[model samples]
Target: MNVFEVTLQPASLKNIVIIGCSGAIGKALVEALISRFPDASIYGFSRTASFHSLEKKPDKYQEARIDYEDEASIAKCAALAAETGPLDLVIVATGILHQGEITPEKSLRDLSAEKMMALYQANCITPSLLAKHFIPELNKGSTSVFAALSARVGSISDNALGGWYAYRASKSALNMVIKNAGIETARRNKSAIIVGLHPGTVDSDLSKPFQANVPAGKLFRPLDSANYLLQTLLQLTPNQTGKCFAWDGQEIAP
Candidate 1:
């Protein structure tokens, strides 16, 4: 079935949590969720405590502060969110591509142990940690999703030209984490779906420096990507758990 044809039943999505609610895609996802699931209680967690800087403030949802680098902060935020009752969906929208002096490596000579570790921390460990703490809170007998923002470059089988050593390796590791988590979650909550999502070349700070090379119709705005992703997500079933999917709903090979 075409993903776009899938309609989410609002009654099934009663509570939601977004881990990186301050990011461009995260903010757009929040807005889309609010519009689509008006009665759902949406909770947002970001590094920033205030929503004053967001282009669209989350006036209808609750917000909290969190730090992906800190395990304590993540645990506290997850616990607070759990208090609202069983979570129907949890999306980890946090990821880093380039920071300050650290950029994608062009060759082995450009790779550094420090930079590689930093990339793994952001792209791999953070989402794994989120699953570690949040998966148990998902509804036991109902359908639930624990999704992390991954990338197309993370697919080893799809890598025709390899240059982004650190970013690629980190996302690959993230894909593995999602797959492993999905297997375990299924054993407990048969309806829980854990997967990685590639948002395509979105128009965000993460893709800003790389957009020049993106094809004309490839670079999607945050709202469009968010809408597409949510549609893809709504169509997923338990049998499709542990897979990585692009925004268009195509499965990506690990």
Candidate 2:
């Protein structure tokens, strides 16, 4: 039977939170979830003043105002969402690519301390902080997933091709935090799986420029990447916690 003909459906995951919901992948994932799990309630967060920033219409989800940079804001958002009951899934889709004042210089001669610190704050610190505050809201006795969008460039062993110094380093650090948290979370909540996912080179503002070097068949649209990611998440066993995988469902060694 063809893959689609096999009734590819996600197991019942009732409550989900998608951070950075206005972004391409987040929007796509939310749309897919709304269609696949009509009874499921999703909470989507975005810095944008309104949910209009997303291409998909909000169905069962409530658009939450969030600022990834502020701990108080994230805490408030998490608290409100948790009031609905135990969270089945928490996806930290937040990440930063480039900011003149926050990212490392392209050349060695232009390196600046300010830029390095900013990148660390946005890419590495923010997600780790979110895990600190949000993972506890998940149901303890049942299977739950906590996943963050990390990059393949983050893999120290896979950095044969190098250039994005700040982006690469920040994502690498984020992976470590996720791995460490996964260990502790497993001990605390055996049913929870914490994952670091690399969504591949999707056609978004964050990855468009880099796609020139990516082979034609390798580049993914946001919808395709999101669907594959959701499928992978569903297939994960509790033992897969702390593991990093590409959107293609291939393991990415730390």
Candidate 3:
């Protein structure tokens, strides 16, 4: 679909939703968005949001529960958020690198079906399910965005010293999901931008284990990455949908 065919509406952040909001990047996005769009109706979803907290939340900001494994719950949460109005922004800031003792495989021999499935479930299935339910909630006339966190290693062409097989593969598949979702969403809402964002090596729990390998000065705090990503999203045009971009706004090679 040609984006030029439709008159682009101004970027809207009136209604916002943050999936996996309990995580570091997710939480930072919540704060950044709140500061940037004070009047926006922000919704946060996590698997562990307390019921009492949700009940006490103000009308402008609410928290709910969303289990990546449970499609029904994801649907319910999306429905609840849309009750007020269609969502202008939805960010799935969830991804899995390691859980407890489980870490990314360092070699081909280290691969296991169990480990691979778990990685796929977190890095791929969760975001795909979110897009499945949330894409429909995107504003049609305005320039809305459905962005999920992706990694740079996901680029098959960029893989040189490959080791993390499942992690890389899961993100690659997630990128494809973003692409397909972008095409379909563009057909309905040409002004909507569906893309994936690589938030860089953050100081979050997800990257804590691998921090040693990161170059000094390259590691970023969660809020720093959040600001960069937010800025990147703000600069995106409808024609650039379906691609993955780094925190600096540079598109990752396909």
Candidate 4:
């Protein structure tokens, strides 16, 4: 079902944080949120020192520098965001499909410890760390969401065409982290919902190289993907917290 077609009730979102805000989907999400919640405060973090668009609107947006490799930076940024008020949402949009000379391995023979580690660090560790620090800041009395961008390839039950070993493994690990965190968050705050999201093939740097094989309707603009994701989040309840959901709001098997 396309969640975007559902009518959206006004969400009580006063503050939000989008980690890895410099990425294509992240930027789109920020813009979408700004348009929808003009009064809400949005915090963004990227590896770079600042985001020009967010910087232009200091009243509604705040930008911070974060290096996923450095836990201290992540902690500091989270602390700064938490000080603003209770966060209604936290989305970890940071992930790496390739870095430097390392591309996804097509076979077991192509896999290397270094390449696997890099994928694990970017796709798993970063989001896990973001959850570790930010999940606690969510409002306990209201419906709050914590989401990470996970790929459908991460779904073991759904993996028919196998390849992209490192990327797949790392994302699978991320799904596990989201599930485990969701359980703990539910225990602490019954209103908190944590889940992984599959954004499909968005037109971005991450999907640009592989877009040739994507079905026509499956290749989505970043803004459209972002809007769909936000709509899906609005439909989530605590009972559906631990699953990985697609852009259309259908659950992806883990």
| Candidate 3 local lDDT, 1-254, one digit each (tens) | 46543332324578899988888888888888877887789999998754322324455888877888889999999999999898888999888888875688889898999999999999999999999999999887677889999999999999998999999999999999999998998888888889999999999888888899999888999999999998998888888899999999999987
* Backbone clashes under 3 angstroms, per model: 0, 0, 0, 0
lDDT (10s digit) by residue, model 2, range 54-149: 455556778878887789998998898788788888898888787545543466766667767777888889999899888989777578888999
Model 2, TM vs. native:
0.91
Give the Cα lDDT of each candidate: 0.88, 0.82, 0.87, 0.87
TM-score of 1: 0.93
> Which pairs, if any, clash in model 1?
none
Per-residue alpha-carbon lDDT of model 1 for 1-254, expressed as tens digits? Answer: 53223333457898899889888989889988988987788899988765525456555588988887888888888888888688988999998999998899999999999999999999999898889999989877478889999998999999999999999999999999999999998888877888899999999998899899998899999999999999999888877889999999999998
- Residue lDDT tens for model 4, 1-254: 33213222346788889988899999999988888888889998999765646545648787878878888888888889989788888999999998788898888999999999999999998899989989999877577889999999999999999999999999999999999998988888778888999998999988888889999799999999999999998888778887899999999998
State the lDDT at 14 in candidate 2.
82
In order of appearance, the predictions have TM-scores of 0.93, 0.91, 0.93, 0.94
Off by over 4 Å in 1: 1-8, 50-60
Candidate 2 least-lDDT 10 residues? 1-10
lDDT value, residue 56 of candidate 3: 40
